[model samples]
Target: MCPPYFSSNTYFSNAIKITTFLAQSYTTMIRATFLSILVLFGVNLLAQNTPYPTRFELSGGTETPTYAEGIAYYQKLDADFKTIKLFTKGPTDSGKPLHLALFSKTRNFDLKKLRAEGKAIFFINNAIHPGEPDGVDASMMLLRDLALHPERYPALDSVVVAIIPFYNIGGALNRSSTSRVDQNGPKEHGFRGNARNYDLNRDFIKADTRNARSFAAIFQELDPDFFIDTHVSNGADYQHVMTFCYTQEDKLGGVLGEFHQKTVLPSLYAHMQAKGFPSTPYVNAWGQTPDKGWTQFPDWPRYSTGYAALFHTIGIMSETHMLKPYEQRVKATYALLEGSLKLLGEKRAQWLALRRQTKAAVATQTDFPITWKVNREKFSETEFLGYEAEYPLSKVSGLKRLQYNHDKPFRKIVPFYDHYEAENVVKKPRFYVIPQAWFNVIDLLKTNQIQMQTIKRDSSIEVTQYKIDNLQTSRNVYEGHFFHNNLEVKAEKQIMAFAAGDVLVPVDQWRNRYIVETLEPKAQDSFFRWNFFDAILQEKGGFSSYHFEEMAAKLLEKSPELRQKLEEKKRSDEKFAQSGDAQLNFIYENSIFAEKEYRRYPIYRVE
Candidate 1:
């Protein structure tokens, strides 16, 4: 690693030597011409050493740097800040390195040491959606600016910043200027899908891609206090160039939730406003005017912020409007991040205190909200800057379509219903017993860094087991997983046997929220709800209606209670009385021969 200020000092030294040599060796006119050319080249070289001066600008704004160029820029900066260390997180689906840059004055990459020194970790992720390359360029500039003038920004002293220069490596490599139709002038940028064609954003909870797996490892290792994933937004046209999505506090839960809603978010926005970048919540509403208002964007676990919230880390999805000029978007992204650093630096102690409190509190939290309902009764009114939305006829499609009329822009107060009420809150169990057979769920839990132990020997324990009563599946393929939801489960208290090596996860830990949200059947993104246990919803065995008809009749004849029930059902329902198949199916479901394990969710909980 190069020592701090080595690049700057060396550049100046080289320039002076070149100038002196040129003046002595050539005539005045020739020397002046040579000196001017040499000076221009020297400045360009120094600018390269400095950050944010992109190759695109060097080329007179005709091109953006390739993914390799972005990585190389960071690597070069690594030399300027000796404390800055670059490491390959791992190879992506495209066999390219996922590089991370960690910076600190002490050159300490040890997170524990940094924490001991009263430093917090601020993790910034860029290029998740390669088309939204604003952060990629912005982060390079931010880190360079901080390193070049460490004394100028006191906030740099409060935290150790780690940045993933380009998260979706494959997407970043698939370059195209036309991919983002609505986006303004980057000249060229990456596509949104990775090599495997997976959207890494949606693969967080599922971990379907190598990128997500690597991210999981990094996230667990750092356990950052604050995180930001940068992007560009596509929504109703608005005056605000930058907007953001923080993890919904109501879903994050406990004091952590309160702190995020009441403190961090407001501070960041306020800071942004002070910087003149006037901010707004992410425009989650589509095909609607902002003046009509919208709700907070739901940051589910699949999203970066949502995953970060599982561990009670403050995470924000920073989005620059795609309609804005690329340079303006990049600058806006840099400004938002710069403001965030200031706020974080000013409130470092409070953030660290809240971090400790929340981590400790979550371990013992009794009730974890698995689902949330919008609290329509409570809302905050914010000024919304937007163009009038109009439905205009499409000349090609011969239909009216929703669009923004930029000719009629207006700013007005609009309701931002940010409040939410918890629904289907679950009383957390002491330990969750997952059968060893369900290794899929076990692997995922482990991937999320939830601690678990294996049963030393075969044992029987009384626990509550969820029987999946009903489930719904989407007709469309989502992120390569058959998504499921609307889970209806019947919990039964019973003694269950587990084999040696069965997974035992104690819920009283920092990952309690993650545990409950995933293990519980009703949670919006539970394993059951995500179709991890969809097999349980299928019955493998069933008696033929013709063969079981005689048995059902005999059973009804033998048992007076069965006979009465059958007679009552027939009398009450004309459909059942007329349909022999329906009667036989009902009898089969009520029979002992019906598969007991069908629709039986394997995860059991011990109180």
Candidate 2:
């Protein structure tokens, strides 16, 4: 058994060593002007000294370390801090040892300990993609901050975080050289393939290659509580904010997914949204795996968010705003990472309870026939769901018609409770809009003097809401994409910019999310559920969907196409099915994101 150490301390150790080792790693390090240590050193000092280093600078620049280098870098530092190994494995790989590093307290690694503590986060970034240096740069700062303040945060106690910081050592070595430039910039920022020209992110659903065993072993060993994929936007379209592609708004949290969504994400978003760093919240209600799922075919990554719900993990995709300075992007990203850990630590009790209940629910699924509610009002619902991720556009689209998009998101509200038997109709109490805005939309409604009441039941909590909009005011008028509005919306270079473009509108649509009709709430209540396993998340509510694991399971079971695709993965990578490659790809697609590197390949069967 591997020894467990304080998770933050483990990080502190990793950060300190990476820098310390990189400074001395080689007699002749990469000497490209862009890959200098002076910048990293200065930034490290600033982060170490400043109460808040303004922004977190993760690494110096484009220096791709060998797996041996990365491992050795941390091992040396791990010796100094409160570091302990959580697990160790040697899996089959095309060329190397499948090394997996997990740093947490000895007690914390216990499944029972995780159950008792209840909050965890994982970050994924597969190698350094020329165009997507944000994840690499940002993680450098995050690692340092954790190392610097091991005792400052108790939240690290309830949290366990993992990072696939570098996946393509070979690819990074051959990547073009330039400053934070995308493929089209600075002479050296467009290369996007790993060493073998394989995209780690796309390889997940069926990552049958040299690194397959590494991926499998890691997945089997450290099934994280949350998965975070760090990547860049497709182009310079959006502003700087994290975007999510998975949810529990549709299903009941299949044993594990419920634990993260119900207990972790809400609190995490709330803390960051409240941090005074002007930005729009990013979340989605459905699986964003267009690669498979929906479009009729449906085989998604079983180790990523698609599997998160099944395993009770909260999956996140950290897509940085492309237009922003890489330093700023990295800073915001580090904060997001830090913020997530804080939420996990603070909500340990709730998360732990949810974890237990989620597990119990899955176990009970065999006898009780647990059902999930799928909202069919998809057109309006997609628009509604779209508001969170593609808002401002959603808001503009809805308002352009001068018609209030249906408050009810979906056309059909089908509860997935009893798929094998007669389904029960979900009783709608006049209106049901699970305001995807971390429950803040509830207050927005109250600000408008809306009539809404939060009711508490034994098993689940419900909010019965009504708007009292007597005046037809344009409160939601063109708010300039939320960037220049009363609230500052951080616009990135990629995503948010897309909606605002072509529209040639009066505002940068990326600045604001869907302008939900706000009538304002007059009162509030804690509709705590006593019986259902959901009440544990009363403080962090308003997720769009749930039960990811069940979603994956049922979908895989029902759809032969999806099953066949997944089966191919099992067959091709049978020998290395449980290696570090599985874990790496899981992280690559799910968390620890970087643009060019993470999204460079396709994971779905290209058939």
lDDT: which candidate is best?
1
The root-mean-square deviation over C-alpha atoms between each candidate and the true structure, in angstroms, is: 4.3, 25.0
Lowest lDDT block of 10, candidate 2: 523-532
Model 1: per-residue Cα lDDT over 269-373, one tens digit each: 887787678888998887566787889988888789988988889899999898888767776888888877777788889888888888899898898888888
Clashing pairs in 1: 536-599
lDDT against the true structure, per candidate, is: 0.80, 0.38
Off by over 4 Å in 1: 1-52, 56-63, 390-394, 397-403
TM-score of 2: 0.46
Per-residue lDDT of candidate 2, residues 1-607 (tens digit): 2222112332212344334433442432342122245455553432221221222222323233334544554464355445333234443232444444444643344544654544454544444343565555455445435555556667666566565545444444454555344432222333456556655554432333344335534553455555665655543233224443443433323545445445555565566557533332232213341111121111123224443343454666565555545545555566677776676667656655665566555432322211223333332111111111222333445542222122422222212211112122212122323322234334333322234433232222233222121212224422111111111111112211111111111111110101110111110011110111122212232212334444445555666865565557667886545764452333333322323322111101000
